[model samples]
Every structure is written in C-alpha cells, then in structure tokens.
Target: MQLAANKGFATEKVLNLHEISHSLEFYANGRLVRNDDGRQRKFQGVSEVIEFVKRNGGERVLVVLPLDRVSEMNVDSIEPTFIADNGALALYAVRVR
Candidate 1:
C-alpha cells in the first residue's frame, strides 16, 4: 500500500473482514480520512471486488490476499496479470472480464 501511495494511487479504504461483517476505513495523505456518509461501510470480498471492477467498466482487478486462501479463492483458475510474493502473502493483479 505504501508503494501504491508513493506511485500516486490514493489509499482510499482499508477493509477488516470477519466471519459476518467487515469494516472499511479510509485514509488520505497518511492520515485517516473521515467519511461524511459514515465511519464504517459494508465489508466486501474478492468476488465482490471483481464485480465492482466490472461494474465500473474496469478490465482488471488487483487482489491482495493471504497465500493460504489462494486455492480457496480459485485464483489459479484465471491467469494472473501480475503476481508478487511477500513471504506468506501474495499480491494478485489479474484481468477479469
């Protein structure tokens, strides 16, 4: 995320997911960005994020998830656009039409 921010992409939201719900926190300029709507928003998963990208007319999706969940998430089913390993974690940037 720091790298992305350094490259000029705003770190808009961070999601903390649980079994039943997720919390999203926004950040800007290295500080927390408050939400006029509300402090917390519904949590979204990788599949939901893919839908969002598709809905916004995006052709690709970048997903950062635990390495253990890679198979659970069916990441191998699709060819990844980019992948980076960071020990037990990984970053998956893939084209999703």
Candidate 2:
C-alpha cells in the first residue's frame, strides 16, 4: 500500500476495510479495472493485493475474469498477468483466433 501510494498508483489506502467495504475500485494503466466489496467474503481484513486487483480487474480481464470475484485477495501485482483466470485462456485464444 505504501509503495503504491509513493508511486502515485494508489491514490488512497485504508489499513482496514471498514470504510472501503462500502465501495472498492481498482485501476491499471489509467483504467478502472475491478470493482468489488471485500466484505461478506473469504477476503476479510485488509489486503493490498485485493485492493490493487479490485482496482485493475478489467484490464487483467483476459487472465483474471474467471477466478472467483474475490480471489484477488490472495494475490498482488508481483507477476505480469499473475492472476490466472479463464479470461487468461480466452486472451490467448483471442490472439490466435
């Protein structure tokens, strides 16, 4: 969260989901990618990965579209196209097709 903020990628970050749960959004390369509420799901508490992905969900759509909506809680932007989703497969197929 600190790194993202320092980099200007993360506009604001919360230590806990109390306020964020009301509304969560993710961004990537200047686009709103993911939108979710981290409450009432396995992704409880505060996780920057969850926050980041939720922010970039759509851009990662090809590779991140199929995973459980809240699966992002388990990962961060550590790898390129890191979150594997059926959308990832579709991305390859689209290129080939």
Candidate 3:
C-alpha cells in the first residue's frame, strides 16, 4: 500500500488476509465480501478491504508502502497515487505490465 502510505493511509502495524483467520476474511459465495472494520485497524484484512471496494466503488486505492503488503492478497487494478508515484523505491509496488 505504498500509494496509501504516500497519501497518508499507511499504518504503523500492517497485516494481510493470509495472516488472519478465515472467519475474519469476508468471501461472498466465491467472490469478495466486504467488512467495515478493515480500514480502522492496524492490520488490514481481506473482508475489510472488500468492504472498502463496496463503499468506495472502485474509485481508486493507492499503494505507498510495500508490495508484499498486497502481493499475497487477491485484487486487481490499482491507480497510482502521487506520492508513491514519485518515490523511486516504488517500482516494486507497481503492477507489472
């Protein structure tokens, strides 16, 4: 979430979907389900992230921290945020074409 970090959405403590219990992860009948609590915690979860997509409606989520933060998770399409875009160390966070 390098873009999110650049945009000031980064958290001091970060966790991904694989790290949490499946129950905490939201899945909608083989699809992604949403969870409101994801955005508020130090660690972000799949269900919570799914919830963000619902409320935000695919607006644009930026990555500004580390690629590994999301590498193991399931997601597609991310718009680059300015700060992360400007950072030279952000190449790892960019989606490979």
Residue 27 lDDT (model 2): 28
TM-score of each model, in listed order: 0.47, 0.20, 0.29
Clash pairs detected, candidate 3: 1-63, 1-64, 1-65, 2-63, 2-64, 2-65, 3-63, 3-64, 4-62, 34-51
Candidate 3 residue-wise lDDT, 1-97, digit = tens: 4444465544322222333324223311222222466332322544454455445544333222234554433345433323332322222222211
Better of 2 and 3 by TM-score: 3
lDDT of 2 at 40: 24
List clashing residue pairs in candidate 1.
none
State residue 91's C-alpha deviation in candidate 3, in Å. 8.4
Per residue, candidate 1 scores C-alpha lDDT tens digits across 1-97 of 4544453433333322112112212222222222468543322455665555566566444445566656534654344532454565554554454
Per-model C-alpha lDDT, please? 0.42, 0.28, 0.34
Error of 2 at 57 (Å): 6.7
Instruction: Tell me how far the alpha carbon of residue 13 in candidate 1 is from the true structure, in angstroms, after superposition.
Output: 11
Order of the predicted models by lDDT, top scorer first: 1, 3, 2
Candidate 3 lDDT for residue 16: 28
Candidate 1: 10-residue stretch with minimal lDDT: 15-24
